[model samples]
Target: MDIRIGMLGFGFMGKTHAYAVENLKYFYKNLPFTARITALCTAHKDTSCAACAEYGFDRACGSEDEIISDPDIDAVDVCTPNIFHYETVKKILRAKKHVMCEKPLAVTYEEAAELARLADEAGVTTQIVFNNRYMAPVLRAKQLIDSGRLGDIIGFRSAYLHNSCMDPNKPAGWKQTGEYGGGVLRDLGSHAIDLVYYLCGDFERVSGKSLIYYRERAGMDGAVWKTTADEAFYITAQLKSGAIGTIEANKLTVGVNDDLSIFVHGTRGSLRFSLMDPNFLEFYDGSLPGGDYGGDRGVTRIECVNRYPEPGGVFPGVKAPVGWLRGHVGNMYNFCSAVYEGRQAAPSFFDGARISAVIDAAERSDRADGAFVAVAQP
Candidate 1:
């Protein structure tokens, strides 16, 4: 049985979902069911329809409802704008379909919680597509942390710094507004928080600041749009495990490539992971004696394996030297299989909702001038 996936949204996330659908069977073994890109949906009829044809979708749907109501599709992958996630996801779940939505779950905390609740109530399986968790090196890092190789983590730093849209002339879209999921915290910090939870434990508290680097930008309609959201975020958090950490993300970083690195100092050792060097993880063990020796503290490259099942080719695995693009594809296969087979999925919507709550707490803390705020654990 192949799980039929209908992807909605044809932008960055749309193409990513499509790529994942197009490459699911090339990596793993024993997928409970086969997966296929059954359809594509977008608000625009022509552009979306063209994308559907170009991407080899079986068909193109004109509306989110059209895709959700299509019984032939087993799941609807939502890559649409964050402001639309809550309503879109609520309807999809009501249609008794599984979903793999982009991060934040919703543009606002209330909406996120409602969507999370609805997904849970529907019991139809859902994931928020925290794709970083699927990164091979990140997985290896988790394994190392679980083994206590990093010892008792005393301090941690996870930052996602990139310079993709630093220019004022970059124009305004859904991401530039404060209300429409338009902020640095929700846009990028969500991933950081999720990574924090994945690598370490839940957050005990977080206190930080978020700033909108640019005040305004050109709109698609050649009008000036307010850039009320932060282009960067700076936050310090306390993990429930007693480890304090800093999580920062900036779109203003010059010459950055989606750099997400976590530095940890433990009681006995330390380890680090940078997304640019996705293949290898770096670890320094203080337990080993060093007698006046000069050693390199460079990060070790642990290439990712991209072997997947039939039709899921080039999917993410232990293969080192893999890229973030492959991880996106692998994530689709994971969620689709989990939905069809009635099993587990990584970074489920609950994880999404929880991280959203963390962001909410951070916002509260920011309002209070960087006071500690406890994160709710599910």
Candidate 2:
């Protein structure tokens, strides 16, 4: 049975999610159940129409409530903006429909927590899209950690840097305004935090430095504007497992896919994953006998595996079809599976809320000049 889907918000993430859900059947014929974009939502009819036409959504609506309230929508996929996540999800849950929302589930920990409670009461499954967890190298890293190959993790470092907002003249978008819940920390830091939790377990505390490198930038109306949001973050965390790690994210890097890569070391071994080369993972085993004569550690490639309705030539993470939605594709697949089978997937609302709290804690630490703050639960 094809799971009918209604997509909310049709911008970058919306388009991406639409692409994933639409082509899901092509990638995995045996998907526990199929999914189709039965409807779409955007803030305006023109935008919604354009997106529906471009993305092949069966129908489009200008308002979120309209789409969520529609009986035809089996599940609501919220992709509007960070600010809308909490409320839209609330309505969807109250309507007794599953929800698949983007990361950093809510603007604040309090909001996230409340939504989680409501979802439980609504008896519906909810998932936050932490797509990076589906990436090949990252997934392999998780497997190694789960297998205890990287024993007694001693230290770790990771960062997601990019040049998207480097231009001081770049006009403000929803991402640059605090009211819209825009900022590098919550906008991009959520992925990094979730990646850390997925591979290293829970964290005890976080200390951070968040900077708005551009105090002012051109506004949407071509006027200079003061910025209230962070452009980058430098964070340090101490995991509950006794491992120390650093995570950084920036949208103003001069030129690069800087956001890719995490280097990890343990008392016994080490691991490395880079988004630049999404296909490979490096590993080192200190206990491997007679390794002194050879190299201490080496890199291994993780072929892009996928699940099966395969357009059959080559696709990323082909080994796991669900992983195909990694960036958004695998994420959508997981969300659909959760909706269809009544299964709760990874990075649930509680998880998203927790990560938001972590970011909030980091931001608080940043304001206090890098004070170490406890990473409280949501």
Candidate 3:
């Protein structure tokens, strides 16, 4: 099977997904299907044409609609701005094609819910790019939780932080403006929220606070502009399973670089993960025997890096240190395989919509002065 993808947005994630599709064959030896980028579309025609020439895409489309409606394209990969996702995803699913969207599926819960409903009705293969979940450590974390190793999860904490917004002199990009659906909460919080939901369970209620430490900053044009988006957001949540946790997203951390970490504690054991140390999952087993000298009671660092099951971990040795981009490759490979095999991919748009619903509640809590807000069900 040949999976022809028409990708929108030639930004950071757009290029990443393109690389995944192009390199999947090398990472996973297969006798099943071939996935390739057949077309490219971006905000600017010149950029799209240039990308086509440079990246060897078959067609340089004028708009996303052209790519979505094209019969030759089997899948529509959405890597556009958050504001554009709802409409573009609807168009893709309505065209009876597969869709692979980046996180925070849409700017609002209502829009994401509608998209999820339409995707279900269309019965098309869909995936949301929560690439962090594809990390070997995260996968192992999920396995341990599911197998009752982290028995009866009681509480958890997660954070995703960056220092990109720490410098007041730095110019504001689309991510620093509210009109573009830009904020650390929506950008980083979405991933953090999904991590808790994925590991623990559905959120029952939440209280949130948003902060803009730097009220004004340099604009994209090098002029001073008011900051309209949150530099940090703090949320405290309760899960349906009676677990409570804190989730935080911050862009004003002075010396952080993509710092995402999570800790989960349970009655039986605990698990910890940090993107800084992406190759290992530190697990604590309370069931283990403990003595005065702390015999076999300390945290066990599980070497999970690059140890993917069959079809993966072949090109790169299993013990090799895996980085962030490897997760994107695995995510894309699974989505394409799902499309080809007529199966639903993990982290579907429904999962994305769930995070949107939680975000909606978080915003409500923030507006209501941190009053607990119930998460809307899908």
Top-TM-score candidate index: 3
Query: How many clashing pairs in candidate 1?
Result: 30
Q: How close is candidate 1 to the true structure, as a TM-score?
A: 0.78
Q: lDDT winner among the candidates?
A: 3
Model 2 poorest ten-residue lDDT run = 307-316
Instruction: List, residue by residue over 1-378, the lDDT tens digit for candidate 2.
Output: 767888888788987887778666554445687788888878888888888787667887877887888887788888888998988888899899988999889999999999989988998778999888776568778778788888888888888888877887978898878889999999888887887888888999999999988898987676999987899999999999889999998898886965567888887778888777665678777666545756544544445444212443244434544333456857788899998999888888888898899999999999999989988864
lDDT of 3: 0.92
lDDT by residue for model 1 (204-314), tens: 988988777667777646577767778899999998888998999788888887888888778877778887876666777777665545454434444445432344443
Error of 1 at 287 (Å): 1.8
Task: By lDDT, rank the candidates, best first.
Answer: 3, 2, 1
Between candidates 1 and 2, which one is better according to lDDT? Answer: 2
Candidate 2 Cα errors over 4 Å, as ranges: 290-378
Which 10 consecutive positions of candidate 3 have the poorest summed lDDT?
A: 317-326
TM-score against truth, every candidate: 0.78, 0.79, 0.85
> Weakest 10 consecutive residues, lDDT, candidate 1?
306-315
